[model samples]
Target: MKIVNAKEAGEQEIERLLTKAAFDQVELNPKIREANRKLFGRDMSAAELVRQIVRDVRNEGDKAVIHYTELIDRVRFTPEDFLVTEEEFQAAKDEADPDVVASLQKAAENVRRYHQEQKPKSWMTYRDAGSILGQAIIPLDRVGIYVPGGTAAYPSSVIMNAMPAVVAGVREIIMMVPPKNGKINPYVLVAARAAGIKKIYKIGGAQAIAAMAFGTETIPRVDKITGPGNIFVTLAKKEVYGHVDIDMLAGPSEILILADKTADPVYTAADMLSQAEHDPLASSIVITDDAGLAERVAKELEKQLADLPRREIAQASLDRNGLIVIAEDMRQALHFANVSAPEHMELLTEQPFQLLPYVRHAGAVFLGAYSPEPLGDYFAGPNHVLPTGGTARYYSVLNVETFMKRTSIISYTQPALSDVSSDIIRLAETEGLQAHANAIRLRRK
Candidate 1:
């Protein structure tokens, strides 16, 4: 990692670095334009596939869903197997480690409690002339939570995805994860059941997303899909977006630590590696004002990486995207951090609270060295599903709001219409919208 002084980078360099690049260009500079020519650049091949699946499911319903599930997942299952029963959930819950079950139970509770505070309430106002306006927040009838099943059973995702829907009062929460040899992970199953999820399907990848979006024989259609997955799954979600609402097009996990000389090297190192172990594409960087502190943190990172079980993966990520930028001062450090808009931002400074006001963009912010990013991932009360690949500048971490929709209500009485009719007609006519002008003009009398 090179320690570059932000002031020396120049305004042009800063602009180039800070500007959000296309999603594919984050870690590597690919010959994408060339590659696209070879592989049909910027086309809707994926979208076409999702459209076909949706049509099949919409027309054929359950039978089409089952056929796709069999073709895609290669797992044969009846409808009974799709919806996990209370007995099956209990068995999975019982089979899990007592300590792990306890931990997951606690994590689910904390997640639910935090999201409960985020629940939107319905409000309305009525005027003396009988004009009324309001907003009604309504949860989706059914929601699908996709948990990655095969490689590592992400029980944390279960809590992060399902708890918000639960808090938002979503009626039916369905879960789909790829089955390992046709069986779901006991821990994942237990966690889902604990998080108030009523359904679990053994499917994964783009096929799983397709099923959720289109609703095959075994899986019912979901109003929205929420969770993380691999490139194919992510791309599938991106493709099927309009057919069903999606949380976000998540990329590889990332963490940016903004620390001062007073920050702990050990904690910073550990936090950086947390995202690094997720995947080689995952990025971990630190912005600091002290060069010596950067060196210390880099040394600690190397030392810590050596001992980690996923050292090879973490090392690859650190070697490629990881950086320690030494800024001229704290102001420059914060400026760089905002431009990056990392998925996870940790303020490991002497005064984390004081520095927080300057943070313009980040999916989630961890205050103080003790508040590690992983605390939000598992045991802490915040959602771990955050925007990645610089989308944090506009997107937010998954919350209860993600699972619900808002509808605006407006009612204008004769008096209200009389008050604003002439203004409305004038504005409409100015825009050459005669029909709009006539609509208001007719009501004026």
Candidate 2:
């Protein structure tokens, strides 16, 4: 990662480096583009491909879902092959290492416990003239979670997405994972079991999103869909959003570290690489007032990446999106960090907690040298499905509330209605809502 002096950089330059066009429409890489050309017989944007796949699934149901599974993922499935059977779950349990299963169970329990506190409480209050105002918290009846599957397995994704729904009291939840080698990853299955997910479909990609949104012959419709995936999956979620609720349009993973002279370069470089290793688009950045620390961290990053298994991806990410900004001071560092609005932020300074009150925007904040991003990603019990691509300014991390809806409760006695009748009628009439005035007027009578 190259180090740039923040004072020398123009505002436009900083923005272009940090917040520029991260949300620009997803583009397919050359390999995927070639695959798309061969499969669809034409070149199309990621949005175009997603729209066609979603429309096909909307119209042809399971048949279209199976067709895309073969074309996109290179995995074949019949309608009956969609839903994972009990035997598969059992096999996953049997095949999984006993210690790993136990660890996942513990992590899931921590997630469940954390989300239980986030469950919104319903309360009613008596008001003047026998009026009562309240809210009813209703859990979604059913929800679908899309767990990405390819060459990797992330049981943590399952735990992060599912536990909140389970804690919110969702009645039924199903999972969709892209099949790899004609079978779902056993560790993911182990996580599903730990998180209390029942129905799982081996189907995946944009078609899996569409099946959940519109409902198929085999897969049932759901109220919301959560979990992160590749660009195509994100685009599909964007297309089907109005038809179904989505957690957030999360982009590639990223981390921004605000460090001071006291911060350790080795720890800082390791943390930065943690996010960079996620994807080639993933961004790893450091903002520090110390130019010496900046140089040391950059050197440490080069040294550490030499032996990392995913060095190619991490190196590509660093070359493309990573940087170190030499800020003037801690205050300036915080200012630049808030402007970036990163998904995962680390405060590695003399007083991490003292800086907390100034943090304006971030999906999750990691405090101190010991609290790395992965702590929250796996065992820390916070939802890792966070807003990225500078969307942290308005979006939120997924939580129990993501699966729960609140409905207002209104109850008014005759006296209460009379007290406000004229006011309501006057406002309704002022707005040209004659029917609304009539309803209140008739009720008054």
Candidate 3:
């Protein structure tokens, strides 16, 4: 990790260090490009590949989904064999360690309880002349969550993505997990069951996204799609966005730690690795007032990297995207953090809560040394799915509101319409919208 002095580095240098390319600006990965060569007989950008895949699935339905899954994932299943059956659910439970399944059940319960508290109400108010105006909060009919096949397949994700829609009274919540061989991951299936999601389809990749977005003979079309995947999955989501809702154009995970003289070097280093292990693009940064603490934390990071199972990925992440900024003071540290607009902001200072009031942008804020990043990732009640790639400046954590839409309600008595008609007509005429003014005028006459 490069350690820089805030006084000499200046805002421009700091920005150069922190700013990542937008998700659309990223080029195709070489591995994915090579894979495309084998599949499509040519190398193409992620967008081109995703567009073809989406069009194929949208046009051909389940046949196209099966074709891609068999070729890419080396898994084959007929359209009838898509959805997870009750018998399959039982077998997954039987195969899984009871202790692990029990833990997921408890975690799902915590998720349910947390989301239950977040009921956005449909409300109204009485206005002058018996005019009633209000907003109605309505839930979507169906939602699909895409859980990846391998290490990224955290059962916690099932609860995190689905429970909010469930709490919002969504009629259907389905899940898609890429199958391994002929079966889905046992733990993921167990979590889906625990989260009260009945329908499970063992399909993944761009086809899985397309299947959900447009629906197939067997797969039900969802009102929205959530969860993360490889570049293809993200690009597929981008192409189908207007057809359905998406969580965000998610990018690499990131964490920005704001520390003071009172922060713990050991705890600080540990927290940094938590995000680093995710991907090589994942950023782990520290902004501190104390230069001494910076050196110790850097050394501590190297020491921890030696024993971690994912040391290679973590080390690459630190080497490429990590930083330690020696800010002049805590206020300066906070200023740099808000400017970066990180996905996860950790307050390792003496009073994290006091600092929280000044935090202008972040997907989620973890306060104090005790509240580590992993706590929010797993057992914590807050949603783990967050806006990344500095998009937190405008986006928000996946919450109950994501699955809902608000409709305005307007009712006016004759007196109420008359009271505002002249003003409305005048403003409409100023905008050169004669038809709009005529509508009000006709009602008045």
Candidate 4:
């Protein structure tokens, strides 16, 4: 990791350092191109490939879904094999360890209780003259959650994505995961069951996204789709956005730590490595005013990296994206953090709450030394599906509201209409909407 003095760096250099590594801006290396050529006999970008896959699944339905599943994943599937059977669910339950099952159940309860507080209720307010006006919150009919599968399965993702929808009273929660050797992960199945999701499809990749966006013969279309995936899956969600609602176009995982003299180097290094081990594209950064602390943290990272099972991946991530900056003071550190708008921000100051007021942008903030990013990812009640790639400036963490729709309620008695008819007609007429004015005029008459 490289260390730089933030105050000495030029403004242009600072801006460049803060910019995120966006997928659209990335170029495929020769290795990736060769692999693509071997698989599809063409060198196509992720976006182009996703476009073709989404188009095929939208038009050909189940046939195209099966074809792509076989082609990409090398797993042949019959239509009957698409939906997970009750037998599979029971088998998963039986196969899962009792301790792991208990942990998932406890995590599910924590997630449920947290999101239950966010559930919106249908409310109405009465105005003068018996007029009623308020907002009505309605749950979506159905939703699809994409769980990444193949090398590893994320049961925590299932809990985080499904619990919010369940809390919001969504009629149906459908989950999709790619099968490995014609089998889904038992832990993922158990997590889905714990989250109250019954509909799970044995599929993965952009094809799964397309199948959910446009209803296939076996898979039902959903009002919204939520989850994180690889670049292909992210591109598919981007393409299918107009057809179906999506949470956010997620990017690689990232975390930024703002530390001071009181911060522990060991804990800071461990937290940074936690996110770095996630993927080669993941970013981990630290900004601190103490040069001694910065050096200690850097040394600790090197020591800890030796023991991680995913050391190669974490090393690549740290080499490419990790940085330690020496800020003149805590104020400068906080300024850079807000500008970065990282997915996860941690404050390791003596008084973390004192710095909380300075946090204007961050998907999730972990305060104090004990609160690590992984805590929010699993055991914590808060959703771990956070906005990434500087989108925290506008987007939010996935919550119960993501699975709901709000309708404006408006009611007016004759006197109420009479009270505003002239103003309404004038506004409509100013906009050259004579029909709108006429409708109001006729109603008043």
Which number leads on lDDT? 4
| Candidate 2 wrong stretches, greater than 4 Å | 23-25, 28-32
Report the Cα lDDT for candidate 4.
0.91
Error of 3 at 1 (Å): 3.2
Off by over 4 Å in 4: 25-30
Ranking the candidates on lDDT from highest down gives 4, 2, 3, 1
lDDT of each: 0.82, 0.91, 0.89, 0.91
TM-score-better candidate, 3 vs 4: 4
What is the C-alpha lDDT profile of model 2 across 1-445, one tens digit per residue? Answer: 6679978985557656778555462373566567678889998777788999999999999999989999878888899988889999999988999999988988898898888888889999999999999999999999999999864788899999999998999999999999997899999999998888889999888999999999999989999999999888898999999999999887888999999999999999999999998888888999999999999999999999999999999998899889999987888888889999999999999999999999999999999999999999989888899999999999999999999999999999999999999999999999999999999999887
**Every candidate's CA RMSD:** 4.1, 1.2, 1.8, 1.3
Q: Which lDDT value does model 4 have at 74?
A: 88
Per-candidate TM equals: 0.87, 0.98, 0.95, 0.98
Number of clashing pairs, model 1?
A: 4
Q: Report residue 426 deviation for candidate 2 (angstroms).
A: 0.7
Name model 1 segments beyond 4 Å from true.
Answer: 1-87
On lDDT, the stronger of 1 and 4 is 4
Clashes of each: 4, 0, 0, 0
Better of 1 and 3 by lDDT: 3
Query: On residues 139-222, what C-alpha lDDT tens digit does candidate 1 reach at each position?
Result: 999998889874567999999999999888899988888877678889998888788777787767666787788786667889
User: Which pairs of residues have clashing backbones in candidate 3?
Assistant: none
